[model samples]
Target: MDCEKQTTEYKSLLKIRTGDKGFKDLSVTCVALANAQGGRIFIGYDDKKKAPLPEQHVTPDEVNEAVTKLRSLCFNVGLVASEICTDDTGSQYFIVSVSPSMHSVATTSDGRIYIRVADKCEPVRSEDLQRLGEEKGAYQWELVRTKYLLDGVALDALRQLANDIRKSSRVRQHVKQMDDVELAENYHLVDEGYLTNLGVLWLGTAKQRSSICYPATVQYIVYDVLERKVRKEEWHDNRLNPKELLLDIEQKAVELTYSYEFPNGLFRKQIRHYHPKLVRELLVNALAHKSYTISSDIMIKVFSDRLEISNPGGLPLGITKDNILHAKHRRNPNMIELLSALEMMEGEGSGYDLIYELNAMEAKNPPMIESSYNEVTVIQNAEIIDTELLPLLDFVLQNYQLTQKAFTAFGIIAREKKVFSTRLSAILQLQEEDRLRSYTDKLLKDNIIGRNGAKKGTQFFVNPQLIKNAKVNLKTTLKTVEPYVLRTLIMEDLRAHPKSKISEIGGRLPEIDLQELRKMIYSMVDVELITEGARTDRRYALK
Candidate 1:
């Protein structure tokens, strides 16, 4: 074989070491490759060289001995080695390709196991080992029986669970005829035909399971960077199924992370304060991949600077931080499948991609994913977002006629906050402008705001459709104004003239409110509703 050519092709998948003495301690490399996806090992070349030229010497006997030793070291696993070969110029090389075993392989004598992740080889933890064993059918936690289950435990929940499982295609086709006892036996929920800890946890009463094993619970805390303390928190136990739990938790997470408002004069229609699809996907991945074996629950930490989602589990076997975008390995396979079936999870594997795209579209840095021993975290920095806020604010500004209740339904405000007039008042103040005709006209001309209804019945909202089409150019400087007074002035102008010129409009307004009026007029100018001259005689007109 062309060793140099092969090495280039498989560089990312395998590690190559060559020109050393006969294969010494290749067992660790073998184990590491096995724990990960299988990869090839090439010998008889000087790999340490910047350009690894092939070595010119090799012994067939030594190669055979090395292969034998490696095979003997890894029980329940096998590897193949090729005979020593020479290139056209008498350069020597030997190739060994390790394949993934049906069974998880470990050192036969010492029982030590290692896995390669990125460039480092690390010991596989017991929990990971257990997961491997379960995947290989060597052992299952569901099979282990706990003596703590009480005899009189409620069977109602168990019956309901059985019904639900029976309805599923996998269980229906494979386990419909099997009764509760028989089904329990097949899943290894029974020990000598008796119910075990797995049965108690899966089918026992809520209170009973609480006594037997802690119910899967999740706690979320949001910290305010300014306050340096938790601003909000929520905790939930095993009330809903895993899929429902994920949805519920994610919704609550969005609530903690975002503040909503519908701004006017910026967009053609109303828009949400944040991208719902991106937020939902991130949280779903967190809940799906999190390690329940680790005692800590998934956490969503929101600060003024960033939003972080920390899941309990790190990368699963065969997955690393580098290849995470391409690799597919589900630590919670059942949960993943169930959520997928429920249509909560996207089919295209676009969760991470969506997060990245949203960040890019908003001109924010891409979200970051990090893995630790006990947790995997995804952090999305919202501090620098531009496009995200522009569309929503534009929508609110254009559709200033809509009531707070209607705006809230359009997703410009939180549902709970909508009920509070204080919050609504805050939203209005944040979105207000002094020049009604100019602001609305400019928003409509720019296609950032669109009109709904007709005449007095006409209302404005952020144009959801227009957001996708609008080129975002967010202003950096924060302009200060008394927004409530400006909003009142705009409403008064609209109620009075219904249509008016800038100078005519300016003549009717109070001098003390001129700053706010001028600011609103400038905003209208930016949106292109009116034309301006070099002097105060600048006029406004509908585009």
Candidate 2:
């Protein structure tokens, strides 16, 4: 077969070389790609296919010898190599198919290991190797032997976690009569007469935890909307246990979020004003699956509009961001189990799915998952649902059975004034009075909407508090104002008088309509520019 035809068959998997000697490097490259994801390497053609092909024949004996050497080098590390076919052309080419190993393979002799990243064979860094080892259940910390007992395993945090477990029926039934050691063993904290990395992370003293690779350390940062770097912090250093550390980090996340209050006649109800659950879930997931063998800590970054949680390690094997919701793999199963025992998670594999579902239900952006060489990050965007739309959604949800078509209709009605005929029919099918009332009840339960009046005379609108608390006007309420006109008026007045009264500002620009001026004033108010005074006189000042 022609080189071009072979290249087309293995576009992503194959890399071509011009000469016969390049086969030696190609062997290792094949191994690295296979170790990551099975791929093939082709020898005898240039990568760009511009160079002339070599006119040499590689004998079956030489091919066997090379394969033998490659296999021998990776034997101790548990990687296998296979020779699939050899071309009969005078310009010889061979195919080597490397399959995903049952175990993570490294250099057997331990000098230096390499993996193909984009198009180069880069040396696998020590941190990355350690992470791979941990992901493959071969973390060295799991084999460390404790020479001394420290303060009865620091049961304060453990006891609190146990109390939480007792409250969970799923965990309580499985934990009956199980002592701390038994529980630890069941959770894989200790393995075959040795304490694992997880044991040190959860129950070991600060000093003990430090002895392990990177046990339960976390970094927290808060940023303004522009990510100007407001606060930089680290947690779980040498003074706190996993439980205390996690709780502390969670509280910090809550503290860093933006909140607003809705006033109801005589009382004010406060809402977090940010998607707290999504943030918490992402952080918790990061901690649970982090590679403890890596020396870095989990990182939480809070920005004005979003929060990001990154852990030191890539996605676990068989778990990619594409299939994260459906894949059920955990790099740190023991840590996951313990958190589940403490009721922090539903179970080992359900957190990601729940986060996605909850975000969908709240009509917020789905959490974004990303993996780099040494880290996995989950980003959560904070979006506050429109206050007025909440009541309408509640009415629809309670009174009607939900379907994709009905959901689309409700979204249009809440956001746009008109719904398509088909969509309206779907929504009408779900719009029973009792169901609408139930939906309203749910909205009230979630504090997203409020209702007033009785029976047929009752009217529903967006909750007043939601309307007032949101930073931007709802889509339905946003009125377009001419920016050039507003800027010209403001600048011209500032240039003429240095400062101006609200009435004077309005009078100076008579072409600016009253409604447009009101909208501009409110926009300016949001950014703290123009100040409204007690009397009719309001002043615009630089602040």
lDDT of each residue in 233-293, candidate 1, tens digit only? 5555455545456667766665444643444466443333346777778777876676555
lDDT values for all models: 0.53, 0.56
**Which ranges of candidate 2 are over 4 A from the true structure?**
1-19, 22-26, 37-113, 116-120, 125-128, 140-144, 150-163, 172-174, 190-195, 260-273, 384-543
**RMSDs, each prediction?**
18.7, 16.7
Per-model TM against the reference: 0.49, 0.58
In angstroms, what RMSD does candidate 2 have relative to the true structure? 16.7
Number of the predicted model whose TM-score against the real structure is largest: 2
Cα TM-score of candidate 1:
0.49
Give the CA lDDT, 0 to 100, for residue 295 in model 1. Answer: 63
- In model 1, the worst 10-residue window by lDDT is 5-14
- By summed lDDT, which 10 consecutive residues of candidate 2 come out lowest? 5-14
